[model samples]
Target: MSHSIAIIGASGYTGAELIRLLATHPSFEIKALAANSKAGQPLANVFPHLRHLDLPDLVTWEKIDYSQIDLCFCALPHKTSQEVISKLPKSVKIVDLSADFRLRDPAEYEKWYGNAHSAVEMQSEAVYGLTEFYRDEISQARLVAGTGCNAATGQYALRPLVAAGVIDLDEIILDLQCGVSGAGRSLKENLLHAELSEGTNAYAVGSTHRHLGEFDQEFSAIAGRDVKIQFTPHLGPFNRGILATAYVRGDSDAVLAALQSAYEDEPFVEVLPKGETPSTHHVRGSNYCHIGVVQDRLPGRVIVVAALDNLTKGSSGQALQNANLMLGAPETAGLTLAPCFP
Candidate 1:
């Protein structure tokens, strides 16, 4: 049976990405499209490339009755998702592609986002939506919170090693570079065509990036203790990918074996052959994440790298993966599209 689905913030990058992937999805029916500011307009008017699909016109949340919807994709921004999700029908399962529910502790959420969570009750009920790491929880959850794009990339490289105790928990360092789309569709002077076209620069330096909360949460959970990693993110000229390099203290063989063994059966995450390295170009525009592990020249150290399309595997794709699990459908349904290449 086809499940009815809605895209709550349908005018942004991840929202449009959800539409693109769901358009060809076999068991998911796009039933509702909502965007507060763009209400009453046709979805295609805002996203011309999606003119071929049949989707509801942009409507205000108050205009649609949630009774017919089986699942919702909350793609709104931080803080906004919490408020909007709090008002939705209780029975509808949600895969929020926002920071609203990713952090489990309300205090942590406030610490990183600078606002008290308005939906603590629901926040307590959400499952982190890193499909590879939280499959069991997501399969049984009514609300699955997606990870930050950079966070997802970083975790894919280091989580397995951390879980296996193959890497030194205290020595983790991540250097990540992300494409422009991860910034969202908002207009900003720094993101203009002229400014970003030929330059590459870093931001959120010295552990100032917010996704560190995710690394702190997941890494600490796996180690059963406090774990912190130095993280820095850089903006690149490309439009859609993330490449993260994690410098860890561990045997290269053990790190490789751990990642290969952990993701051995998972469909979306793959540990590449030895000596190989991940690149954003390789996994661009797909739900797939490619990870590579190698030994550094210095003994007792390993260099782990992972690549993925931030908008897909990092956000909407992960959301759909969780939705499939929640709806009791095949875990990989509507998500088999391979990475785009030249």
Candidate 2:
């Protein structure tokens, strides 16, 4: 129950979120907070909201000794995590919150990331961190890869259907809208308050977004064949939450039943009754996903909607879930907080 943990890239949005969750975690101690760019600064200076918590000051990654840390949460940028994780001691259990290890295929990782995976051997050892489906594998894993925020949302609305054969996997279409934080804390002209506040638009149209690799891997595996879905993600002006609407050919009642049956015993996923849809605000700031389904106007079609805070259930919170499994702790530990509603 006594586990020492470190967050490798502690200066970003997701890193701060992880710190907030682990602050309430009973079995773990936050031993190190590393941010190469913000070295020597107090975490309060970088993330003022977390100033209330007593935490380690930000330092360079090299200053922390992995020999003393039992688990590490890698919140580094896509290509950066591979480099940093490669150098860590093998004894440290890793829950990588980046795209680096989610794909088992090193060649596919290179294809989407534009660089060959330097830790190809380690990549093969990492387990996909989809907690519900990969529970057994992740519980015994030393290194686990968290899914993309958008990818996780889409799967929430559709994976059960694919596994139960309740929906037409070949015709599934996932249209997702995500909050600004999903884009990260970096400075981008389009993300400025002036430009992003008033409008919402879609990016990564067609099959171009990097998260498609995850959908391809997951959906195909569940159906026991090659199954691909049309996925498009939109950028919303809000600060948190993601709402994914998936259109599939299926019986509305069966889809609802499948979701409820799959997640009723689970802590994070909530499946609403038929005809009731979900809004992102309801699940905002919590490690919960609310899913609902209704009959589509087109005959034999159904619309499944799922909502979650992209930063919570989709990223950091998910990283913590996998870590709990990896550490033999309760899967829902430190993650039972109810959604914050106005």
Candidate 3:
């Protein structure tokens, strides 16, 4: 009953995370690892922490024998993912960890990513990869699209309230703090330790963050109306988590009730007691998302907070979760590890 798997873009943060989680999976066997740039190198050479486990050496995606792979996780960047996924074999189920397939409207994808989608037809076939809300669809889909980390964090805090009509849709605002790893394994001047260690600053301000497109698409659909939330993201000095605080005009009790009801049965999402806020540290290195609700001193105003590992629940873990459902395995099969907390 073990599912054969392949991982493309296997040298990136999300790619490495998928390997780390799958290493202990009871029903998944890694059959191939693809990293075009590191094609001939052993995975251990690229990620030393994973040296303990024996895994396939990195190869290019074209070199993989997809006929043997039951599921393939594409951790490539946006435009690249579309181009590559379009060329992949149709028989293998795919879980894309890029922004490429998340937006169904090609125009919206072009608007946010500034490039025309290469695979327009496949766009119609991609099921959004927010595991909790899209579980039923994911289980039946051949292609699943992983959500943006920031978008996932915010949605875990707001989607329930939006659906329950317990909050003012037009007045919602989400301010998030994300760790450096969310930027990926790529090198950048700003990510240097000397430059980022002690400070935190907001980037993608004024609702300019690309994840807003996701918020708009998902929230609007839930309400059957346009719902735009002002979102601002900040890059923190840390290396692994995301914490988002949502400000909304609503009855505090109702907001808590909505969130509790929405995730009461979800294995990976936990709703904390009212007045208790979550922290990024609590869910680091795990597939769990923790959410909390707090009442504002002024009545009818509430603050909802959510935290999760940007690389785990936000991307690879989510992809694997969808893959499990698509393959008929227990949804929590390879994802039950506890969060890494110091």
Candidate 4:
């Protein structure tokens, strides 16, 4: 039997990516779509790239009967998602693609998000949806909070090293580059064609990016101590993908060996052979994460690079992966699409 699913923020890029992936899923059915601003429009109209499929017309959340939805993907913005999800039926499983529930401590959330959490109770129940790290928890979770795209990419590079004690926790630094689409489909002066094309600039520098919260939370838990990493994100002119380069104090062979062993069994996350750096173009439009490890000239340091489609593996693809676990479907179903090439 196909599980009935609803997408609450259908007009956004992540929401549309979900529809693209789930369109061929064997046991999942798209029963409803909600995008208040585009409520009366057809999904095809909102996202022409997905016009080839037969899908439901968009509607306001209030117009849908929640009793019929078995699962829901909440892709709304930060504050709006928590407010909307708090009112959802208790039985509906959720995979949230927002920064709302990723941080467990309300104080920490407020510190980073600059707003008091409106759904503290529901926040406590949301499993951190990093997939590989929390598979068991996600399979049983009523709500799963997706990680930030940059956080996800950086963790793919450093989490295993931190856990295996192969890297020095205190000296970690992540310099990441993200495509403009990660900013969302919303209009911004900087994202304009004449402005964004053929140019790149760094933003959220000096520990200001919110994804640092997720890194601190997950890495600290893995290392059994407080682990803070310096993270800086840059905006590239491309439309999708994230590439994170991490500098760590560690032996090259040990870091490579540890990362290889950690992802040896993971179907989606791949650890490339040593000295082979991965490019974002290779994983674009796919749910795959490619990681590369290399030694730095400095004796005790190594550089780790990780890449993935910010919208796919970083967000929507991950959301679908968690949903597959929650719904008891094959973990790889609807996610076998290969990466696009030039």
Compute each candidate's TM-score over C-alphas: 0.98, 0.98, 0.99, 0.99
lDDT of 1 by residue, 22-116 (tens): 98888999998999999999998999999988788999877777899999999999999999999999889999999999999999999999999
Worst 10 residues of 3 by lDDT: 204-213
Worst 10 residues of 4 by lDDT: 42-51
> What clash pairs does model 3 have?
none
**What's the best-to-worst order under lDDT?**
4, 3, 2, 1
Say what the RMSD of model 4 is: 0.8
Tens digits of per-residue lDDT for model 4 on 136-212?
A: 99999999999999999999999999999988889999999999999998999999999999999999889678999
Error of 1 at 280 (Å): 1.2
What would the per-residue lDDT of candidate 2 be over residues 1-342, giving only the tens digit for each residue?
689999988999999999989999989889999999999999999999989999989999988988999999999998889999999888889999999999999888877778999899999999998788899999999999999999999988888999999998778888999999999999999999999998999998986899989998898988889998988899999999999999999899888889988998998888887899999989988999999999988889999999999999999999999999899888888898888987
Top lDDT: which candidate number?
A: 4
Give the better candidate number (3 or 4) by lDDT: 4
Runs of candidate 1 exceeding 4 Å displacement: none
Model 3 TM = 0.99
